[model samples]
Each structure stands twice: as C-alpha cells, then as structure tokens.
Target chain A: MIENAKVCLYPKNPGEVVRILEQEGRRALILAGGTTASQVRDPGVTTLVDITRMAPPTDALTHEDGEWFLGCNLRIQQLAAHAGLKQVFCGMLCDAALSVGSRPIRNAVTLGGNAVSVFRWSDPPVALLAMDASFDLVGPERERTLTADRFYSRHPRRILKPAEILKRIRVGVPSGRHGGAFFKFARTAFDLAVVDVAVCLWFDSDICSRARVAIGATRNVPWLSTRAARMLVGKRLEGKSIRAAARAAREETKTADDIRTGREYREQMVEVIVRRTIERAGDNALGV
Target chain B: MDIHVNINGQAVAWRANPGENLLDVLRREGFASVKRGCNQGDCGACTILVDGTAQRACLLLAGQAEGRSLVTVEALGTPAEPHVLQQAVVEHGAVQCGFCTPGMLLSAKALLDENPSPTYADVCAALDGNLCRCTGYKKIIEAVLDASGRLRK
Candidate 1:
C-alpha cells in the first residue's frame, strides 16, 4: 500500500525518528513492526522511517515504582510471552495480547501500532482501559503522558501530531487482593472479536473496594462503563451485585449492527461476557 | 532503494521499493519458498523467520527487512537431506497440494526452536496462522508431534 514511497530511512534513535518525521511531515510514515504497514494506502507517503533499531533491544516489559512499563515497540508476542506480565492482573494483559490475530500476526504487530491504529476489534486497548494504563508520548517539542481514557478518547493518530510518537505504555500493578480478566468472543480463534470485555476488581475482606469494566468492538472506541463499575463498588462480589453490573454495562454500551453480528445480539453478549469476566476476576482475586 | 539483510545466513543486498512488501521482494529475488497466499495478514502463506521469530512477509514492508536476519523455508532442508520435520510430514501424509507446507514448516521450525518438546496445544497455537485447506490439519499436527519426538532424541 506504501507503493509510492521513495525512501526508507532506518533511524537509530527516537530523536532521529522525530527529526525525520518533522522533516518529511505528512510524507513520512513510522514503521515499527510493519504488520499494519500494508494497510496504508496514502498516496502522499513518500518516506518510511523504520524504528526497530531506535533503542538497545531489551525485554519490553519492565517493572518500576509499582507500575509496569510496556515499551511501544514491544511486539504483541513478546507481551504475551513475558512471564512477569503473565502474573499481572491475573494474566489479563497476556490474555488480551495472545488473543490478537495469530502467532505470526502477534510476532509482527507492535503494541504501539495496535494502540495508534485504533480498530474496533483491537484487543489490548480494552485491557488497558480496564487497567487504567497511561501512555507516554514523545514529540518534536515535548514529551508527555496521557491516561488510557484520554489517549483512546479518539483515534490515537488524530491525537498525535505528525511528529509525535507513542513511546511507552504505563500500567499500575494493582496490589492487595486485586484481580483482572479479559474475555474475547470471536467467530473463530483468528477472526476479529464479536464482543470483548475486560474487568478488574479490588476486594477488601470480601467487599468490592474498586472495579473497572471495559468493553470493546461494540463501539468505535473501547470504553470504561463507569455506571457498571459503580454498581460493584462497596458491594460484595456476589451474584446480585455482579448481575446488576453486567446489566448496567449492557444498557450503557451502544452497539451497532455490523457484518459480524447483530446489534441486539452484541448487546446481549455484552452482559454475558461482563458477568463472566467479573466472576472470573473475583475468583482470581479470591484465589479460587 | 537498496536494503542489506542476512538471508539464510548469507548476507545479501537487495533492491526494493519503500512501499513494497517483503513477500514480493523475496519472490522476485528467486526465493520461491516465500509464497504469497493472502496479501493481507490473515493467511500465513508467506511466513518467514525475521530475527528468529516467525512473521508474515506479506504484511511486512521490504524496507523492514533491512539489517535483519531472515530465514525462509528454503533454508530448512533439501529433498535428499530433508529436515526431520519434513521427513515426519512426508511419513504422516501432511503434504497435500503443498502450497501451505512452506509456511507451516517455518512456523513449526520456530515453535520447535523455542520449545523442542511442544505440547499438542502448543503446536496448534504455533500453526494457527498458516491455514491449510487440503490436509485438514490432522496429519500436519501429527507430523509436528512426530518431528518433535525425533528432534528430542
């Protein structure tokens, strides 16, 4: 799709990447894992700034100051294979990462590409939304961080200026009887999700202290259902509370009929998936 | 544009376009083993090992292969000295029509390289990307299992 491109520059550092993007303006495209590059059909793109060699290669997952930092360049497979991340939030992040297309797709798709290209079927955003992650961004002028809620408020490509790059994703590791779960319902193992849900719960002596319920593929952007989450706070994670939260999630999420499934069916499945995901998270938190 | 890459352990400089995909470039360079099944990322017919990880060639830009080490199914083995995985596939009748075999073999090679003794589920997960309409995957799975055992010995 980048058939009209003229130059492909391998930038050795983020600064070089920023400069090249600035110099090329709309003519330059950043190529990380390159899995989605084939989808680019812009006729104006004439330069490709490859960033695989921008940093010293290391494990993309790192823990610092009670938070997990996922380098934007991290491949989806690397995120899925990280033993440390597998233990985080009951392996919700790993589950979401592994649910992406397939092994080869995961091997080539970067977390940054997945985040920046906000497709409706994207998986990691749902988990990140539920985890309340933050994105670190670097641009020609400054570097800043935005919460996942804000970062995903619109297409990340729109949020990022022409020279801006998503540097890393920061997710706080929950402590003290917390658990999370991600459930993706797809037509096939490799097909795009019909409806996906992510849930995180914190408990204090059997009472739900905090909760986050995020749904994806049902809307243009994945979103956290505050009303659904509110139903769980201060209530025990029993059948009654879980059902109420699931019902709220289904009601609040506005789904549209698509080629994959019907709107009413997706809305109904939302409730089912939310309840199941929350129940799984509750079980994980209780070590059941 | 010119890109330098280590292909099957041999360093080669290849001419390519910035927007062209790796599958077309490799095929044009006489690497017939890298088949083009689905130009999109959905089918893994063009699976190749980039820096020892299996990735789709069709989805990857040719420029992305610059400075990287790549291994296609051509590097696996010859007919006279077939790789154990190839031998197992032949013995298990896994090669019907043989179009997806190259991609499947590379995916399997990647899995076995990382985990020599992969479970049935591991093999399935590893080969999930490469779809085969002929074999129905039963023989392919069995062949991979047999090859894993032979490699362990």
Candidate 2:
C-alpha cells in the first residue's frame, strides 16, 4: 500500500536499526516486524529497513541469588518454549505467546517489538508487568535500565520515539511461593483482546503474602491494580478476597464503547476475568 | 530491488519490489502451483517453506525471502509420480474444489520435517492457521496423518 518505499532486508544487528535511523535523519522509517509499520502512511519515508535479525542478545538467563535475566531477542515463541523459564513462571509467558496470532506471526514477532510498540492487545506488556519486568535499554544517550512502569510513562496514550532500542528484558522470576496466570478474552480464536487479566500471586501456604493483578486491552499500558493486589495480600484468594479484588480491578479501568464489547460489559467482564485468573493462579500454589 | 532466491531447488532471480509479498512475486514468475487465495496472511493458500520453516508468503516481504531456500508446491512430484503426501491426499480424497491444497501441502511438509510421527492433535495444530472453504478439512487432516504414518515407515 505504501509507495516509493524501499525495504532493506537482513539488517546485521539492532544497532544497524539505530545507524540507519541516524543516517536517514528522521525522514525514513525503521521497520521491525513490519506488521503495523507497513500499514501506516509516512509521507517522508523513502527506506524501510527490516529488523528481523536486528534482535537483541539471547546470551543469558542466569540467576544470581534471585534476580533473573531474560534476553530481549528471545522471540515470544522462544520464551514460551523454554522449559526452564516456563517451569518458573508456570505458563504465564506461554499463555501470552499462544494468545497472539497464528504460528507464522508468532515465529517472526519478537517480544521486544511487542513491548516497544506497546499495543494494548499485545500480551508481553501485561504478563511482564505482572511479574515486575525491567528493560535494558540502548539509546544515543548511553545505556541504562528502565522498569516496565517507567518505560511506559504514557498512561492512556501509548507512543514511543524512533531512536530508542530495547536491548534486553529482565525480571525477578517468581520463586518459592509465587505463581502467575494470564487470561485474554477475544471475539474468536485468533483476534485482539477485548479485555484480559493477568495475576501473579506470592502465597505462602493459603495466606497470600503479596500479589499483582494487571488489566490489559482496557488501558494504554498494563494497568497494575495495586488496590486489587493489596486486598488479597493478607487474605485467602478463594472466597471474599477474590470478590473484593475483582471489584477493585473493575473500578481501576474505564472502558469505551468498542465493537469488541460494550463499556459496561467490558467492565463487568474485567471483574469476572480478574477473579477467575487470580483464583487460577492461587490454585497453582497447591501444586495439585 | 534485484533479488536471487532458491525456488524449488533451483536458483531463480527476479527484479522485485522489496515491499511486495513473496506470493505475488513467485506467482508472477510462473510458479503456478503456489496458489494465491488470500492477500491477507490468514488464509494459508500462500504458505511456503522458507529456510525449512512454513511461513505465509503473503505476509513476508520479497526481500525477506533472499538467501533462504524456498519450497513451494512445484517441488512436490506431479500427478504421474506424486510425493507420498500427495498420494495420501488423493487416496484420502482431501481435495475438494482445491483452492487450499498448495498451502496445506507446505504446512504438512513443514510439520513432517519437524515430526515424522505426529498425532491427530499435532496435525490439527500445525494446520490451524491454514483455512479451507471446502472438503470440510476432515479428509485433509486424515491425509496429513496418513502421510505422517507412511513417512515414518
């Protein structure tokens, strides 16, 4: 659909994405995964550099004491398939990856791209946010680390500059009593989410010590329901706490009248999904 | 852009648009077997094996296919001496109207390459992305499983 656009395939690395951006001097588009980028109309665009190989490093998944490192280039598919990471998170990442489009889409769409682009329907942002994920960033102003919350500062409006390149995504993998789960509701088998909920529970026995409930597809970034998480910290997740947390999650979001679902219906569905996912994550603590 | 790609075991060159999907480019170059049904990536009628992995040719940019080994329906043996999968499909009566056969074949080929013995569930999972308006997709699933069994032997 785009005219006068030239694509440069086989970018050697992610840095090349930055270099070409610099060389093109803001006139061209730096395209990685070309899913949404190709669809847009950028009049100044003359070149489109494909960034499939420009993915970040997959060098380490080490654990020192408690901190865990997840490589940025780790494809959403790759993250789902890693047996070690899956064992720790218990299908949290896998659920997110499986929730996206079909096989070929998953095969090419990287985790970093999903996060950097920050589409609300995208899974990584909500799942990673629930687990307290951080990013190792590389930019013109030297390299630094930014938490998922800080990395996504625009609450209701999701937008990012072209110059920022995400190097790696880091998370403190849940250990001991922590467990996580993600649930997405779409119109059909493969479609964007209307409303989704992800839960990460740190329960020592039946008593929940800490918890995080993130609502997705209803907000710009993953809306971490601190009130919902707090309501469950001291109580059990089975009965009253579930109802209260679900209520808090509902109050935290303000949905619009989209074709997917009505504003009232989405708010109601959010409560339902939150309660269900939280209970499901809590059930995992029993290992039953 | 001028690009060279290995098409069905032979190197074929084309002066292509980098933004163009590989499906149109391949079809233009007379690989008639690579069906073009859906311009969108959903329908698997344009599926092809790129670097031994099944991918939607409609979704991939022509420039992205460079340096990759591309296998399309043309590579499979003809009706006179059909590939084992083609034979299985015909025997199982999997082709009806048959707009979706080429992509189905590539999906089957990619799965068989990865798993010589795939269960019925595995076959369904591999072909989930590929859609068919005819044959009810029942016989096609059976054909893939049947081919998997034959290849395993």
Candidate 3:
C-alpha cells in the first residue's frame, strides 16, 4: 500500500545511507528488513531508502579487542548461528534470535531493525538491553554511540534523528561468572510475545555480584528495571532476594490494557516472569 | 521503474511501481507458484528462494531484489516431472488445499539443500512461517522428512 513513493534509493554504505537520510529527511523512510516498513501506507514517505544494499560483507560478525561487532543488516538467522556469540552470550542472544517471528521472517529481519524499529515486543532489544549492547550511529551532522537502553528510551520511535542511521551494534563481552536467559510468552511460537523477560546475572560463587533484568510487551517500551537489578546485587539469588526483585519489577513496570491481555494480568505476570527468569539465570550461572 | 533479476535462472526485465514488491513483480511475470496469501510477511505463502535462502517476497521490494538471483517453486520441478520433495509431499498426503504447498516445498528445499538430514524439530522450525490450515502440519513435516530420506538414496 506504500504507493507513489518516489524511489527506493540504494545507499552503498553507512555514509551514503546518512546522506540519503539527510536529503529526504522525514519524507523518506529507511527500509531495513522491511518486515514492518513494507506493510505501511505512509503518505509522508516520498522515498524509501533501502539500506539492505549497503550491508557489510556477509561475514559481518567480527571480534575486535574483546568486543563483538555485528553489522546492522546481519539477518536474525545469521546472528543465531554465530559461533562466537553462542560461546559467550549463548542463551540470551540465540534465544532472542530464535524467538522472533519464524524461519522466513528471521531470514528477512535484521537485529538492528528489531531494536531500532521500536517494536515493543521485539525479542532482541530486550535481550540486548540486558547484555548492555551499544549502537554505532552515523548521521549527516555527527556520529555517536548510545547504549541499548538509551537507544530505545523513546519507545515507539527510535531516538535516531531524521539524518542518522544505526551503523552497527557493539557488544562488550561479559566477563566473570555471568549467565543470561531470554523468555518469551506467546500464544504460539510464531506469535508475538504477550510478555517477555530477559535476565543476565553475574555471580561470585554463591553471591550475586551483578544483575540485569528487562521486561517487554507490558510497557510503552521494553524496560531494564535498574532498581530491580540493583536490589539483587550483593545478595544471593535465593527465594528472599528473588521475591524482592520481582516485587520491585512489578512495581516499576508501566502496563496498560490491550486486546491481547489485560493491564492487571500483565502486571501480575511481570512478578511471576521476573522471579522465574532470575531463578533460571541463577541456575545458568551455576551450569545447572 | 524497470528492474532486471535472474528469476529461476533466467534474466528477465519487468516494469514495477516504486512501491511494488517482489511478490507483485513475480506474479506479474506469471510465476503463479509464488502465491500471495498475505501481502504482509506474517503469512509465508509468498515465500521464495532469494539466493538459496527462503525469504518472503512480500517483504522484499522489487527494487531490493534487483541484480540478485531469485528462485521460485517453479524452478523445483514441473507437474509432469515432480521434484523429489513434491513427490514425497503427495505420497505423504500433505497437500489439503494446496495453497501452502509451493512455499512449504521451497522452505523444505532450502533446508534440505543446507542440511540433507534434518530432525523432526528442524523440519518443523524451517516451515514455521509457512502455515498450512488443511493438513495440520504433521503430514507436511512427514513429507519433508520423507523427501530428505529419498534425496539421500
């Protein structure tokens, strides 16, 4: 239904993508995977800048100086199969990748698009927030890096200015005894998450040294409950600590009634999901 | 605009609107095997092999597919000479309405091309996007597994 669009501009690189973004400004829509963009009938978009053509070489996963650099266009299937990612951030990255849509959808969806498109139930953004991933932004005026949490703070729309494109995402490899798990609660495997949770816990022997807990589909944005995460620090991930953190998560989340589920139901499920995810993360940390 | 792509190994030219997708363009070219169940990507009835990878044609703009090799269910085998997978699908009684067959066959073809041997779980996961309302999926999975065994022999 995206009729009368002027052209689907093919940019060669991030700089060219930025230049096109600058030229068209808000009148242009950047097409990454086109899963969401293609279906839109945006009367405002005169041009569709197809950024998939500007993709880096197919082998886009690279490790440099301990940080994992992923091309913005790397398909979800590629990200899921990435050996290095499987080795380090196994459960969190792969599980989120596998959670998105289905096989053909994953073949077409990109990790960057999943995060940058501001889909509330997007699996990767929540997992990336838990992983503390940062994005590389290239703009006509400036280039910068922002943490996953900051990049998604605006919720429904990406924080990128009209002339900026997310070039890549850089993830710092987590050190120490850390375990992460991503869970999506959907009616079926192909359905979008009614609610999802991601937990990354760092433990020093029996004590929890650090924690990151994120929840999606229950708020305007997928949120990293920093307060809840902080509550788990310097404590063992036992029943008492988990209950406190789960209570904090439910308290902090902003939920609303929607067609799929009710506000109270989501709020109630938040406590349950958080408690279970934290316990699963604890088990993962112990290699159990 | 005019875009040229190698569809089913033949270079072809077609006129497309700026907003037209590969699904529209292919259907115009008489590749009816590329069915259009959902213009949106949710339904994989329009699935086709783009560079040996199964991708939804609805999600790909005709311009995005330019200069790339496109494969459709038409390339697999004709009715007179059915592909191994197509034959297996018939033998397993997978086709009920038959609307989801092309996409299912292409998805299974992509998987078997990469992994000649796949577990039942892998077969199910590969065809997850292609929905079949008729056979309830078990027969489709069995067909793919049966085809895999046949391809090996």
Candidate 4:
C-alpha cells in the first residue's frame, strides 16, 4: 500500500497542476495513465495527481510551423488510429504503439507514459528517438523543450523537475525522400521486446543523405548509434554499406543479461534487427 | 474519499482508499465478473469497458473512474438471457475452464460494438489481452465469428 496516501488531485489546467506540484513538493506523484504502478518496484509516493484534465480540450495532433505537436495525454490507441501520424511518421508511431502490451493495455497507456517510462517495453521512445522527437515540458518555474536523447539519457528519468510535466512532443516532418521502420523481436506479439530496432533514412537521389539508427532494450537507455548512422551518409544504401552500419551498431551497443535473454544473444539480435530495419527503411525510401 | 461511477449503467457510490485499484473495488462491490488474474496489465482477466473502450481495471485507480461509465461482464447478460456472444461461446464449446471468459467476452463485445463484422486478424487483435489457458483459442475465435454473424442478422 502507498504509505501516507493522500487525495488524488485532478488539475484543471497546466498552471493548476504546477501549483499542486509546487504545494505538494516531493510528495506529489503525477499519474498519467496509471500503468506504471505495477512496474514500479517501490513507489515512495504520497499524493496522486491526475493530470488527464490538464490536457488541452482540442485536437491532440496538430501541425504548426512544419512540426507536429502531439499532446502528452494522447493514449496509445488514439496514436495508433491517428491518420496524420500514420501518413507522416512512416508508421513508426502506430507500429510502436500497437507493439506495446495488449489491446486493453494500449487503450490506457498514454504516449507520454511510454516516453517517460523507464521500462524499455514502453516502445514509442526508440522510434521517437530515431525520428529526433523533442519533448515540451511545463514546470512551476518555466516551460522548455528537451530533445528525446536528453529526456531519456538517464535511468528512471524524464528530465522534469519535481513540479514539471511533459506538455507535448514536437516532431519535425522530414522533407524530401525518407522512410523509417521499427522492428521489435519478442517471444510473443504481446510480449515486451527482447530486442528492438528503429531506423530512418533520407535519400538524396542515389546517395543517402542522413540516417538514424536506434537500438532499444540493449542498454539502460535506448542508444543512437552515431557510428552506424554516419556510415550511411554520402553512400548508397546497398548491401555493403548496410552491413557495415549494422556491424557498427552491434559493436557500439551495450547489452546485459536479463530475464528475457542473455547478453550475447541480445547483441546478435540487435545486429540482425538493425540490419533488417535499415534495409526495410532503405527499400521504403527508394520506393522499391 | 467517496467516488461515484456509472457501473453497468447504474450510478453507484462507494468510499475508496486513495490508491485503491478499480478491480479490487469492483470485486468487493460484487462485480465478481471482473477477475483478478495477474493484478498487472499483462493479464486481461480484469478487463472492463470504460466509456466504450476495453481497459484493464487492475491498472486504473478507483478515483480515476469518477463520473465515467463502466461495464463489467455482468452487464452483458444473465444465465437465462445470455448475450449473443455468450450464447455463441456455449454453442461453440468455447469455455473450458471459464476463468478467462469474462475478459474475452468484454473485449469481443467492445470490438463487435465498434465493428460488427471483423476479420480473423481483427478478432485476434481484439482478444490479444485475454489469455485463455483452455480451449486453445481456435473455438474462441470461431465463437466470436459466429456471434458476429448472428448479430449482423
């Protein structure tokens, strides 16, 4: 049981939420979708603050200045059904959202929870990391945006101050020719990922302009393989280049033994999945 | 705190602890249809329809259900007048142990409510959360399809 449990507060607005957080201080626990309780080993929480009401009443998905603003309260099921996301984000959001847990769980799990969850199975972060998504944070003091890397760089972290909450996620639509793919290898379709890979590539005529390869469940944090990504720049996305990049990703990735699989097996799966995801993305980008 | 929610279309009030889960509160309120399986979101035994969407009650706090509509398996039908899906389950011999039936029925109901005619893949996706250790899922899928066919007419 939650020791010293207090009343759950439903904040009407961002400012109200901040006020509650500021007043409660360390005792306040922000409950987005409430799925994190089961996974949390010891939730030294006192007060439960429900921020669902703090969400904007309008559309969760909006395009402003070439960037898409995704509300933090948008549930995974809504994200999967989002037509604009499916059209622009290259199905990564849908794939990741659909890949998380089961249909019932997905109905309640919010995109913000997935982004901030230390649980690696919270699938959207890897795909969002590859897509270079940034988070909009609102605190008692001020509001700012943090890149996905900074937001997820530490364990059990969201880069939010005690009274801060993630407001929205900003993802810039990649211009020109580009494609992306998210591949998760798990025991079952509903199970957590043993190894997951997300790859996004931009093609300039015959040469690849840019690439982002992110491997998840391989480390404490989802890691972007800069070496692997750099290997594809200015080179044709062919078998040789893809193989080198995948190998680089495998080399750069850090894995540890877990209940899911062994370290060596995860490393090997990472290489295999990274290669497959890159090839899939390349094929999609080339319209093949 | 005192929380009020619409359960099975009836407004009810109950005093709940600050962090009490909806599943526990529901089971205590005699809604035994909402089972307690893994207590985690992994299992669908505690599945219920919250505002027409299938969700696990185990993960949701009692306070979160305030002023929202909740439908447990009890709302579907009684033994005399079983829901069409329940009738199909019986006709197709879909209940082996019957522990997971409530969740499957609710999930299937949510799916059929939205899309009356669902394909095999759609049915599989809808019932992905509800795990039936018995019946091997073949008869369960067939039962859902049969219910869909019956509902259409």
Best by lDDT: 1
Ranking by DockQ: 1, 3, 4, 2
Question: How is the predicted docking of candidate 2 categorized under the CAPRI scheme?
Answer: acceptable
- Kindly list the per-residue Cα lDDT of model 4 for residues B67-125, writing each as its tens digit: 78999999999999999999999999999989999999999999999999999999999
Name the 10 consecutive residues with the lowest summed lDDT in model 2 chain A.
A155-164
Model 1 lDDT at residue B9:
95
Q: Top model by TM-score, which number?
A: 1
Which parts of model 4 have CA positions greater than 4 angstroms off? A1-3, A38-44, A156-158
- Candidate 1 chain A: worst 10 consecutive residues by lDDT? A52-61
The DockQ-based CAPRI class assigned to model 3 is medium
What lDDT tens digits, residue by residue, belong to model 4 across residues A1-288? 353555778888888888988888877777777788533333566777777777464128788888888888889898887888886647887787778888888888888877776576557888888999998888877898888778877753546777777788898988999999999999888888998888989988979998889888887668799999988999999999999999999999888899989999988988899999999998888888
Note the residue pairs that clash in candidate 2.
none
Candidates, DockQ: 0.84, 0.48, 0.71, 0.66
Model 1 residue pairs with clashes? none
Query: Given candidate 3, what's the lDDT at residue A56?
Result: 62
Distance from true location, Cα of B46 in model 1, Å? 0.9
Off by over 4 Å in 2: A7-9, A54-69, A155-162
Looking at candidate 1 chain B, the ten consecutive residues that score lowest on lDDT are B34-43
* DockQ-best of 2 and 3: 3
Docking quality (DockQ) of candidate 4: 0.66
Instruction: For candidate 3, write residues B54-118 as lDDT tens digits.
Output: 99999887767767788999999988999999999999999989998999999999999999999
Which prediction has more favorable DockQ, 1 or 2?
1
Each candidate structure's TM-score, on Cα atoms with residue i matched to residue i, is 0.97, 0.92, 0.96, 0.96
